[model samples]
Target: MGLRTDPVIFSVSVALTVLFVGASIVFTAPVDALFGTMSAWIITNLGWFYILGVTTFLIFLVWICFSRYGRLRLGRDQDRPEYSRLTWFAMLFAAGIGTILMFWGVAEPISHFANPPQNNVEPQSVPAAQQAMGYTLYHFGLHTWTIFCLPALCFAYFVYRRGLPMRVSSIFHPFLGDRIHGPLGRAIDILAVLGTVFGVAVSLGLGTLQINSGLTALFGVEFSKPVQVLLIAVTTALATTSVALGLDRGIKRLSDLNIALAVGLLLFVLATGSTLYLVRGSIEMVGVYLNWLVPLAFWNDTFGDTGWQGDWTVFYWAWTITWAPFVGIFIARISRGRTIREFVLGVLGLPTAFTLVWFSVFGLSAFDIELNGPGGLVQTVVVEEDIPGALFAFLDNFPFASVVSAVSVLIVIIFFTTSADSAALVVDMLSSRTQEGTTPVRQRVFWAVTSGVVAATLITATGRSGLDALSEVVTVIGLPFFAMGFLMMVALLRSLNDDTVPEAVHHLPTLRVHLPRRRMPRIPRIPRPADGEPAPGSPRWIIPRPGGPGTERPGPERDHSE
Candidate 1:
């Protein structure tokens, strides 16, 4: 694989491990508490606003991408696709359907179905069954992708148009212009780098935890925490070294594995669980998604009575926005040869379709457990000690628990591995861009190492505490950045509307948005008193003709003075 031979990637990986272990001393509990409090506040209060704004913007963007920029392409319109349809779809699938989805697709709906969170101050009220579907669709639907689309659009324009490096600040290119290499630029890059680190590290950490649980459940391997961590570290090291071999080998293989495992797991669940309900839920949720689409799209409960709106609607938007920088950049890299409309549709809409089916299949499985099974998985996940216990509790009721366990382990391992490889690539992208066309290998090494160190530090510091704090930190940082990001998209969209302007203004490769010209509107003229009546003798309100002094356009002499 030529992986271990890559000195730069290998050295960076080792350095990351050493630095992270040292950094843990400063990762404190109070920091976690602070972030938790902040996260709760934002989710409770400002969540809906974020959701509404992001969703509205995305709907408009989809329209622009299709109606206005249908023929728009990015890298260069060519006959060959950026990637084979299969590879392309798999890449999108890999980027999104990670560890959380694997567990939550089944677990979350069950939790909500059993003891739906108290929608209001009422003592024992539960969300209605119908509201439950809406809630799931809400979290897994447009708003989630809405927040995600901002950075996708940003990265596309910046990478393709501005010729800047692939760092997050490249997003600000339409606004910041030449300053991208300056002090302000450095700050943007630093925050993005840190956020990306926190994101990947948290996922790795979570993946390891899940791996431990799955191994114990499926294979009776009860390693100590330290041993468990070592296994994870070793696994990560191996993956990173493979990444050093470059994108074509390690990352591609891992991502491919991730897709296969996830699909296999879903199919297994479908086979074992209630397939009828799974199919029904998918059809029903899809309909609910389209039917209440707008109300759900913008629903911000000033009153928290509807658990559906507040909990799922806003939180997913913020969460997706939080990941946009890293994920969007990754999407852009794989999207070079795709058209603007195709990229938007593939990245934004198609994923939603996949998610709807995926969640329904898994969710209905959980619901089936609650409705007919003996385990109280739906009733007890929140109180369960860990994610695996909760997920395992549900699986215990399935017909072949051992097979499900095996699939779960596979799902956890490959998903985490896929993410680690992709993250290595993303970090490299952030690090590599230098002054012009050449991407610096040293820069790539620096970021890859930086990511490892951050992950390690997060592990040592309050363990998962650093990750929890960092997720909140990411949300806080992304919010204001989103405002500016939105403005830039707006400007680009505006430029698309004006047919006389150059097509390059909107980042598309052609003049695709122009509409056929239409007749100008008619205007009325003022009557002097009556056509036959004597002229209203120079009425003080007398208006001038187009070429006269009284015209809206002043005389040339007055114009020159002004």
Candidate 2:
């Protein structure tokens, strides 16, 4: 395989990334302060925009799913899904939010339970628990996936159907036309590359911390920067191997393993913990989430001025938006041959349902333990601020604690591997000139190593605070993409409307009336002599003309009676 790199996009993105990483290492305080201030301003001024923008994206995706465009496939009419449904869902889920779910499944809900967003709700009360579950579902549910769905749909439609290059700029083909090949397009792709690198780097950093915490819990390993950096190196090396193996052999297998392990872990928790309580709580949580989704989606803390929405809702929206490019492109790459409806519903529904259950299983179990059984989650998670350790602490209540904890650690590592490899692949696609065949293994390895370096550098430079600062940077970078999301919707809608219906879809059987066959009046046959002679006294033969029955034409006379 050729290198196939876009010189401008690759070089500029690499240089800027190196500069940012180097500056973060040298001027950590000032960079952090600047990002902190910018983050504060965004939350204060534009938090409403993030809320409304994400809500709009969700509405737009739903509308497109049910609209006339729903049947449009991401690829050609003859193309079918590249992977089985099970594997497809596994890859998307593993790449999209597997790491986030594992990291936050227990911590977010318990944090909310300990300190409810609203002042009216009492901490650790039933109301607080209900609100906690509702908010957690809101954060990880439809809105989160919708942010991913828009760009993925756009990229898939344009690249797979319209045959554009596989890059973020391809989404703008509807608006930019061939200008997508110019400097503007390069800039768009470069921005995507940067966002993806930092976004994945931040995730790697978070995963490293969680892994470190898990190690600390199990083997009493010291939770320090050196250990975390070493963890990043090891996981990054594994991710490099996966990406080098290419999509089907490397990423798909790892995603399958990740989901299997995750599901197994989830099942073990559900079977061992308060099964009945979790089931009932999960059902009730669904109800609560549905009832409050609208209000919660539109909630911007306008009147409350409590800043809770900024910290949780707006922050989550911005962070996920930053992830849209990496996750979106990766999703589009694997989502070929699927209908718009299947894409939207599957992307929006299944993972979300799984996330709710995952959260409920872990979250409710934590709640039950905190409320009825020996209570230590609140003290560990909320008071002590040991978010990463919360999962291990919660698992200690159940049997096979060490084994399950080890499984959880393995799950996190696999999740980290899948996410890093997927992001590296996507970053390579964004910066490259073409994605016709297998991507260059060296480029994928380079990105994988780059992501690890950034994560490790940030951790070593400023520790956990560096992760926080990087998150702020992501949110700030995500703002432009959030705005671009609106343009993408317009572009997608325009292209869909202008597109001709596929012949396969157009020829589908439809309701029609089959009337009884009408018998036509048969004209009397006249016999002619074999010698081409017109018999004497034979009238001119009349034949029916093009018009109905009455129209006739004169012909040579023939003898009917022999």
Candidate 3:
């Protein structure tokens, strides 16, 4: 069959993306300056919104997890999980934050330690160390995952439970109803497309820069835009091949590999580094994180006037929001049949736990080198500003530096490829008219190549400044989606309140109550409905009937429940 593409979404998104790339290439300086200015303005004015908005999402997700809705599955009551728990966690973790953790696990902590965001702590002191780990965890912990969780929950609930297409606009169906297929819906999807494109491109650009830095450390390769562009080309090609293999055979396997390799690396560092210190530090880190999470979540640097919150915390939140469309949809696709509780806890807990350990190992090891052993991380990362090379430099102080560094490089490459391939799949799904089967290989290839082109263009047009510009651009692009997040929560809550309990669930065995031998009044039973008709007082949307709102075909059966 031919590709089932949405002409409006696909054509318009492609045209706009092409225009952006061409304009950036032709007017690189002006575009960079404009993005920078806009980003700065956002940080100064809307920083509070990002902080408060994300905190509200976290609170909302927690409430949903423990509330009555927690028992509700993303699919039908008879449906069960598609992948094993291990594979499910692996896929979500890899696609969500693998590359980013690798990039920032070491660099961020050290930077924070050297220059704590708060002025009360002395730089490079013990207080600074505690502050560093606390703030790092704040950035990468519960709040970050909550951003992904909100959108994913909305998407999965609508698509699998309500039988809607797997598009961002589908989440707004309760508000828009059939208008989800109208101009407004198309506009929403297009915005999602643009956000996904640029978000993935920014990540691709970061991966390219880091990969180049790895090459420079290993083989003395010149760290320049030309080389980075070439690296993007090579990895995008690999991603294209993976995209063609489809999710099960390609993304799934890569995700499994990513987790395995990452675990191996984590164990290696734990063994080779100061094990006792790392363990003790990790426990303390968790304590500090829990103690300060509330304050940290609300702290917007209002009185401090340091601008550090905007530069780091707000920036990270915006970056994650930019990623919400792509990551959320990918997560929703793989998250069928899980309960809202399981989905929320798994998405918010597992990867976050791993991230804490990952950062603690790398961060504490670097701290050991700086505080007790030799000191070089401060100079390399904070002073010289070689953020990408910080990981390799930290490894240099360990045994078999080259081997571990090479493994790190390979890991980055695979992370880059997996992200690119998964993004291509999601973008194609969003832009497609049909959501029944595997997307056309040619369409997936088009998006994969398009992402590569965008990354390469950003690198070529402004060099290192391009990465900074992309960060700013992502911050601005993320604002709309951040606002959309609030609407999604409202829509989802409204839909859930009106939802009916599944028939199968009601029929399940229940506990019987023993009573004393006394006369009891008999209660009348409710009347049942005729065949093809909804039960009395029940929502009509529960039953699939002719010429009804529930006439849409049920989603495909991937559930393996008995």
Candidate 4:
């Protein structure tokens, strides 16, 4: 129940941090630079993988949606607790979305606006800009969410129906069945745990990195990379500690705050910046998203400007696909009692809509800076500035610099915290046979702390390269699991009408003895109205009208008393 009960991840994290700190001291500056260079290179070379993978996923989504199995639901739990609408929305919008959404909400649209996709109209053109937002909607829409819903449905059904443990590996039940308790299952759990750790912790690192860069640019502070790391570690530690307190009090509260801050960030930029540009881009993004949605989902586009594709579109897809396992598990935890149709629609569509609003609002402000605002506001600050830093600078230029900066920092802290905490909770649920909230609070603390250490080590080893390596690992591992999940859902559908329950419980009648041996055909005969009367419900039934038992017509004019 206490930290002493479980120490694997915590011990590993400490050892990795010590090793990383030690290795850095003797390493040459050039070697360290090489590590950074390598991360960028990986992002470049493997970029196409994301594009191909996500495109394939998109095509699959359309196929599934149109297929007979698309609307399938798992298990027959007709009664379950339904989350209040507000709570459901808050949990998903805040805890479910990763830090990338927060980071890219503003920056992504701007990048597209600065250099719209090749096929897209010229940058800042009212038509082009708005269409770009549609791209945002398209990517985040059904294409992204279907995968998330699949696993969620898997978890809820297996947990409630079969009484299996709820881990990421739980999705493999149809194939693995009883083998889920073997080493292979453990391996799956470990990967999920590690992936989630790096994913959530690095988000904190990103936030602090941006905070340092923004403050240095805005308030003239010494924004050393080392200092940024320490700040990330410390800030993340605080949030993690809060998460240790438990979901109801800690994660949920922070999630609420994060959503508020997120909405506030978008609204402020929209109101104080250029409202007209944001509105125009939003409309355009929706159109672009819908029109190209199907085509982009499956389009290989290998020969068509692979370079640009590698950078923007491919990178984004890989990023999401990489995140599917972690997100899938988290989505599963909250998606209990949700129908497969509801799960797919809510997970995929709502997020897409939100992504559009975020990009449109934030990206348009960047357009103003690049086009009409300060001289270097758009290019210099954005292209010139680093990832998270760019958005902060954009905020600084607005009406209240201090207020925006403060809000930005708050959003980053809780956003990362909620992600990390919720992930830990999911891992706990999946790790053991118990449902979530049943895990000892102390056990949760261990997972959360260990995950932070894993992220810290990855950061120490290859900088953010660890995040990439971790992602690649999850994507590869999750593929087969996803396929197995697909099969299980299909099989489950076939058995929907059959009841394994005891007949006594299912309303089977009890008969002590048979009536005096009157043999009849195995099948029953149909009933008919009076000879001259037409059928009550004409043509509804295929059964022929019967004058005697099992006969379609009168049997040689039976006597009246027969």
Best by TM-score: 2
Question: Which candidate model has the greater lDDT, 1 or 4?
Answer: 1
Give per-residue CA lDDT, model 4, range 122-167, as digits (tens).
Answer: 7666655565565655555665665555556556666655666766
TM-score order of candidates, top first: 2, 3, 1, 4
**lDDT of each candidate versus the true structure:** 0.63, 0.91, 0.91, 0.60
Candidate 2 lDDT over 1-562, as tens digits, reads 4677988999999999999999999999999999999999998899999999999999999999998899889899889998998999999999999999989988999999999998899999999999898899999999999999999999899999889998989989888889999999999999999889999999999999899999999999999999998999999999999999999999999999989999999999999988898888889888988987999888888788999888888899888888999999899999999999999999999999998889888999999999999999999999999998888998999999999999999999999999999999999988887765356789989999999999999998889899999999999999999999999999998889777666677668987999999999998676665564665557656555678795765789999999
Clashing pairs in 2: none
- Candidate 4, residue 494: CA error in Å? 6.6
The TM-scores, one per candidate, come to 0.78, 0.89, 0.88, 0.74
Across 1-562, the per-residue lDDT of candidate 3 in tens digits comes to 4768999999999999999888788888898899889999998899999999999999999999999999999999999999998999998988898999989988999999999999999999888988898999889999999999999999999999999999999999989999999999999999999989999999999998899999899989999878998999999999999999999999999999988999999999999889999899888888888988999988878788998988899899999998898999999999999999999999999988988888888888888999999999999999999999999998999899999999999999999899999899999999997664376799999999999999998888877777788788889989999999999999999888767556677568998999789978997675787987777877676654689875878899797896
| lDDT by residue for model 1 (1-562), tens | 2222224323543454455445445546655666667777877777766766777677777886767565656544463365776677677567654666765666566555655544532211223444555666667666666565657666765666555677776666556777876767656665555556666766666666666776776777873456456756765675566556665566666677777777777787787777777777779878766775777666666555555544555555665665666677777777776777777787777778878878777666666665665647644565553655566666777778888777777767666666666666675565443322133444444445555556555665555666666667556655665565567576556434453357577567665577899999986555557754555544454555679875675556545564
In angstroms, give how far residue 338 of model 3 lies from its true place: 0.7
Clashing pairs in 3: none
Q: Count the backbone clashes (under 3 Å) in each candidate.
A: 1, 0, 0, 11
Segments of candidate 1 deviating more than 4 angstroms: 1-24, 117-129, 305-315, 434-449, 494-562
